[model samples]
Target: MTGPRWIAAAWGQSSLRIWAMAGRKVLTEGASDQGVSRLGPRDFEPALLTLANDMLPLDEVTRVLICGQAGARKGWVEVPHAMVPCAPHAAPPVPAPSRDPRISVGILPGLGQTDPPDVMRGEETRIAGFLLDRASFDGVLCMPGLHGKWVRLRHGIVQGFRTMMTGEIYGLIARQSVLRPMMDDSWDEAAFRHAVDESTRHPETIVSSIFGIRASALLNTPAPGLARARLSGLMVGCDIGAMRTWWHNRPVAVLGTERVSTLYASALAAQGADVQALAGDRLTLAGLIAAHERTGHLEPSAAAHG
Candidate 1:
């Protein structure tokens, strides 16, 4: 156990998470709020060290594997998108060198679609991890977050994908609009499904129903979670409707947290689609570790030297 450990980290818009791995087994982990959005010039290195320095040895050279917005144009370095119709790890990751020679960092590239114009960063790494062991998996991947992604994976290769702003739209209506007051903090399954079915069947009625939320709240005060569920379902239903080709009666593997993935599973199942959800943390780490192993960022022999 006395050896140099490899670093696996993920930086998002709001948070940074890292795991110290000693040959695939995590030795320690840490998290910080120093995500890309909160960082500026000369801040990336410090931010990473803030979470990693203590876990690393002073004499050994550490290898770091990172993904997410840290590789964005405004992040640590702008990594070119790995054009789709390529293996998950087809293109070598972008090299990210640093003034500090104590460690070396490699940022995995995101994927992009040309004709329809779409791009994704961190999620691509997560998908690569999911497919690391499932080389034969050929189906749709539903990644739900602030901006959900619908991706196509064929024979372990990332074919293409699209993004949806359903979460953003939900935030706007649930937190900023007049419809906000009617939304409940808790979930109502019945109400949620009702909205999904109705909205998917008749997206045009969403506007009128949106107004009804406020009216119901102000006058009738019909139910506690009625508005909240309906709003969520309506938004998701619309998203699914727009991307019917991706999920219509097709099996999908959802990657996200319990709430989001479960909701997607429920929505797709209602449409007679087979759905499976793989939560975020586990898979993201898997992807990062896979990248390090495949790229030889952390070789077994190197650990003995450390």
Candidate 2:
């Protein structure tokens, strides 16, 4: 209360941060070196304290609400209690306040099992919040990333989802595998479309076709750029093929970067399905804020740090 008071909020793979007020103005800032792996409570406290030391005098700050991956960590002394269970059919409308008021922290649980016990450190909750109020659809929501997710949401609840190692696999093959020599770092729309065409037509060939990048250069079948595009296509195409049954007659919404979304849109269009693309960052942020609001931990006046 004497010097400055602050609140901190963080999401995703980004670094740890702090938010404070200077004079009549609010200041939000963070440090890159102070980042943590995930919000496991055990791993977060040290990081949080380190971040606090770097950005602000720890004693000056009053209240802190730790959420997201860092907040999910297992062991931290700052937050000492858990919310009690409500009645089976009479769950509380909002999250209850922590009995101790020194520091307020809530660790949201990840959706476990259902699909190989997949744990989304932060994205899952954010995506769930983003889908609130959307009409019910019996289709697939594909989130393309290093570890891609194909989620099926029915009646506003995640019915089931599948994770594919598409992006990571592509990066490995493109950067370290034998295919690296034959790939061009340049972009060619024609090559991309051709790859998409091949992938859509023969999805199952992706596994073997992945190595075809090297073969194509040696055999003089495709240019370096074309080979790169074909590799991408094969990976995406294989995923699409595996997911085809899920999207057969249903509308599809793709949430991710423009390139991947565009490719997915092209592939989906070929299958005669309705496709819509949403901004991945926007959705992720919205979902996160929504989760915070729903849990009553976030308020309209709450300012995000970093």
Candidate 3:
């Protein structure tokens, strides 16, 4: 209670993000590439110590809170999951005993669905944060990332959710597949819209249309940005079309830290769905902070400052 009061961290497969908290207020935040996926089991201690060096408490105990893939089977520790239909704020944090006596870490458990066998890790924290802020948010949340998630929240509990590997597919094709050389980091709203419309109406044509990307660049030589947007639109369109049952005509919100969420917003909006965009990191931090407070780890004095 004398030094930095809380440490909140989100561990991903390829990235590790941290926040130093003075009670409920964040003092500083940082990120690194030393995610669990890239390190050995024994590397977590050194990795966390290095990343959190500046925020380490001096001669005082600091409560640490964590969420995301870091609690997965392959992460810092495999925390037990809380079943769905439970409040994000009510879900308990799994105590992750640490070797560092100055720090006690608690990882918020991710939500699980058993009907069709599905699970999520980090995104659940953001969901809790969003719901914490909105208080009354209901309907569907579309979180776009390496794996796109469509989650349903009724009242305050998560009813169910589904995942789509749209971004993964896009990355594979753009970075390693035949489309690699045909595009660059650029934007073409018109071309993207066209592809979205075409795909939304007839996703079955996706196989044939995918070939057109290579052909267009080879024959007509359209702008690289145009071809890139076309490809993105196609994949995003396919994802939305397939998940129409979950989001179609429903109140859909897009949450993410990148432009992909915006693309999803545009696609969902264009297709007659109510769309709202929520900033990513703030929600993630909010969720972590909420968990700390709920678990009686968040300091009341710090909460006021935040």
Show pairs that collide, candidate 3.
Answer: 24-302
Summarize candidate 3's per-residue lDDT along 190-263 as a digit string, tens digits.
99999999998888888788879999878985785887899999998988888888887679889996677889
Report how far off residue 262 is in candidate 2 (Å): 2.8
Residue 45 CA displacement from its true place in model 3, Å: 1.9
Worst lDDT 10-window in candidate 3: 297-306
Candidate order by TM-score, decreasing, is 1, 3, 2
The most accurate candidate by TM-score is 1
Question: Candidate 1: global Cα-lDDT?
Answer: 0.82
Which candidate gets the maximum lDDT versus the true structure? Answer: 1
The TM-score of predicted model 2 comes to 0.71
The TM-score that candidate 3 achieves is 0.92
Query: Of the pair 1 and 2, which is ahead by TM-score?
Result: 1
Task: Show model 3 residue runs off by greater than 4 Å.
Answer: 1-4, 297-306
Residues 1-306, candidate 2, lDDT per residue (tens digit)? Answer: 322244444434546544443322346555454444444544555565555544444333234444344533442322222211211011112221333333344444444333355544444544554566474555678888777887776656566667888998899988888877777886666666667667767787777777766766787765546767778877877888778878878878888888888888877777677888877755544443444444442432233221
In model 2, which regions exceed 4 Å deviation? 1-43, 49-103, 115-117, 133-138, 221-224, 297-306
In terms of TM-score, how similar is model 1 to the real structure? 0.93
Give the per-residue Cα lDDT of candidate 3 at 100.
Answer: 76
